[model samples]
Target: MTGQDTLETGESVRYISASDLRGFVAALFEEAGLPKEDARTVADNLVCANLRGNDTHGVFRAPTYLERVRNGLYAATPRINVEETAFAARSVDGDNGMGAVVGTRAMQEAISVAGQCGTSLVSIRNSNHYGMAAYYVLQALEHDMVAIAFTNSSPAFPPWGGRKPFFGTSPLAVAVPAGKEQPYVLDMAMSVLARGNVYVAAQAGTSIPPGLALDKDGRPTTDPKALIDGGTMLPFGGVKGAALSMLMDIFGGVLSGAAFAGRVGNPHMDFDRPQNVGHLFMCFRPDLFMPMEVFKSRMDDLVATVKRQPRAEGIDEILIPGEREDRSRRRREKEGIPLSTDVCEKLDAEAAKAGLAQLNTTPAPFAGK
Candidate 1:
């Protein structure tokens, strides 16, 4: 089965199976000089984002990633090195590796250390733009450990009072294991929506809803391309989102000796130099205070209590955080991922440039073969 969607611009979208998408992306990366394993790692991360309904960070980014790797701005096979700073704290240098690869290794290090020390923090520097932050947290969940992830990007927004691009639309994710209910997974961006959302709109040639962005002169605008050109993204809730974004920079960039305070190079725009992105990953044993099963039971209770509460007007039901994404993942697993043809065409062009075959996509939506 497959899916399709229509955009305001009249561009049609179709579904691409996860395996086919992964194979296409991996083959493109391999053709661009990445090792087979590293290419698949990157593909998996991007496809997982798509499956989880985070299209802004999904395979839509293949062109930019391939460009960076081919140009040497992003290291294809980086020499990842880790330095132990404490029993439970480690610092990692990614050697400008692909952000997904760097992040996967760093989180694995965190899981290993937390297994031995009950808690661990692994700070990373010199990485590229990692995809959705939840991927790492989910990795920790597979090991039955609670995890938190933070990463700072190239600055694309402003602080509370200023309009100059000063803060990255930084994001953080957290996950907790549960016994009978779905695990708690939360991924949030400081901005009202990701700047990548604007890029997605721009690529589709559609107008964004008003007030999500401001022009360089601080006037509200709805033009996605305009926002990408010289405008800034509005942080959600004005000051609070700005504050959390700043906090992410402190944890992910400042502490890790990576670029911060509007200095991290933009992964898409700053091709002249490395992004030098930073990430902070923390994991802890859920059984630190009680039996693992008991902890999971409490988590299940937490979710049940929330779901049992009265629903708000027009709300069908109260859903725990990550439930929507979990549902999307399950549905996509069965019905393939819906991707805009514009994005598909771009990916196909990139594959052609690398002398690889184009991606396979379904023409109709959810039609049984």
Candidate 2:
């Protein structure tokens, strides 16, 4: 997919086609023992993130995934199992598998069940980082259904009013299909910033915005490295975000019978054991609640009404949550994905370490920057 606008002056970057990036990533995963199809699925989900401006959750994570595979902390050939199944619910055991694989299977199962039962929910355990939650919810949208997803991660934030880290930057995502408008998708972390954003900032040798996190001693700081040095992320809001993060911890971790609070391992560290991350997926067919035709028309009307709102000074137009991402996806699909020089270097190094063919391109440097 094509990237956004060109880089600013003095900004060094390279552009890679989404298809090529996907092939290289899939090859690395395949070399690490994942089935070809599973590798491709994972690659597609990651690359799609880059195409949609979520570089924090995209191929920048390849090195970490490779390291986990090499350490045997992440199972490349996992034996996924369905622990329990009911009319509209299920429990899945990921067997320490990649989050993309486990989440895809669980969401697919939920979609199938929802098709027959009108709604479904699936809980997954023993999964690794699932990349972006949007990837899974979008899957349901493709089937003309509404989807909701939640996942817990390594400890990065503290409980409300506490300094010790006990909660993750848990994420929640929801998506709904539309008739004449882009699907409505909302994907976000409960922390002031996603932990991945701090990693990205560190990679770029940049400081995070003030108030996002604290230093090792619990003093507020902007240094991205603080996140790696036992610092804690601030909640997005004073107490509300912490409440949501805690709720997700209960639903995704405790409810799924997986590791929660500080017990969950970080995928990039603590290689002695798997992350044992947890996820929850829910799907519903709109037709079950209203006629399909009426639902589509109403969604269109709702979108138009929201967009028609008056704009403030300096504002061009009001856009919905997923509109910008949808535009980015379509543009990148025709152009190409942009990767900063540092990210490209990391990916190249990963390819060499994996004994796979490195990207064979003489990237055209961004002009002027």
Candidate 3:
């Protein structure tokens, strides 16, 4: 087929390769003052996000992130320090660094420690937006480790039964490596939708789905603008989702001595102070309970069994966790990733402002599979 699909909101978009997007993003960040290595890290993460079809957490956020770094809010280069350390756990201070950078460092520490200790947990504070939680999960997957990642973000939704926003849309992710099947990767936000999707909608001049968000007055709304302007997002599964959000705040923010209870600065709005976002990363060898080959075989069997189960009416097939995204990534790698016209224009304008080259794009129209 074509590129499987493109543009979540049916907006006009142009397709480009992953390498080109990564280069442009890295160059943009470097021009904005981040170190080359750090910029490349962030670029790779963003491009991976886009390849997985999560444009909300993808390069769509570059402008906002770049602006925050250019302003005094985010440190261009901060000292990532371990505030406390133990054999199997550690607490870190990001020193107001970019969230993705801090998260990458923290997750790397977790993987390194877990390699020797069998398991490791790393908590970090004073960070900014860390993008997709699954990015860290993929890092662990590279090492054949089971991984769990959590992060608390800006206040976007209310607690259960409350009208006013009081909780952050904390995101959670888990990954388990497999031999033949696609690895198990589950990444979800506590809110009905991540606020980044709302930002993306606003960029595309489209409205959000009804029941996904509310205006400031607690009335149901589809207007992304209204949702961002003091509006509130609904929890994914009502109280259950709210309860999980609380856990993320505990593990990522409160337990890490970072901002909690809706105190994390909004990356889109709060410029007076640092986001001080928090993250938790846990990883362990999959063979802790058995041989490595046995674990892999078990995972493959589980996936095969699940895929053999009967499907509902009109269903074509059963997809395990992360399978759809993995499929999207494969298609995008060959056909190219799609960037919305709106986002492209904004990025090009930003690049011109920074005296940098605009996105080097290949013209490929959206042709749904």
- Among these predictions, the greatest TM-score belongs to 1
- Model 2 vs. true fold: TM: 0.95
What digit string (tens of lDDT, one per residue) describes model 3 on residues 86-132? 87998989999988889999999999999999999999999989888
Taken over the whole model, the C-alpha lDDT of each candidate is: 0.89, 0.85, 0.88
Hey, what RMSD does candidate 1 come out at?
Answer: 1.8
- Tell me the deviation in Å of residue 125 in model 1: 0.5
Model 1 residue 345 lDDT? 81
Error of 3 at 309 (Å): 0.3
Better of 2 and 3 by TM-score: 3
The digit string of per-residue lDDT tens for model 2 on 1-369 reads 122333432236667678898999999999888999999989998998988878789998888887898888888989999855677899999999988999998999999989999999899999989998899999999889999998888888888898877888888999988898766899989987878888877777778889888877889998888767888898898799999999999988999988997788888768888899999999999999889889998999999888899999999989888788878777766666777777777888888877877664334523333
Local error of candidate 2 at 25, Å?
Answer: 0.5
Candidate no. 1 TM-score: 0.97
| Winner by lDDT between candidate 2 and candidate 1 | 1
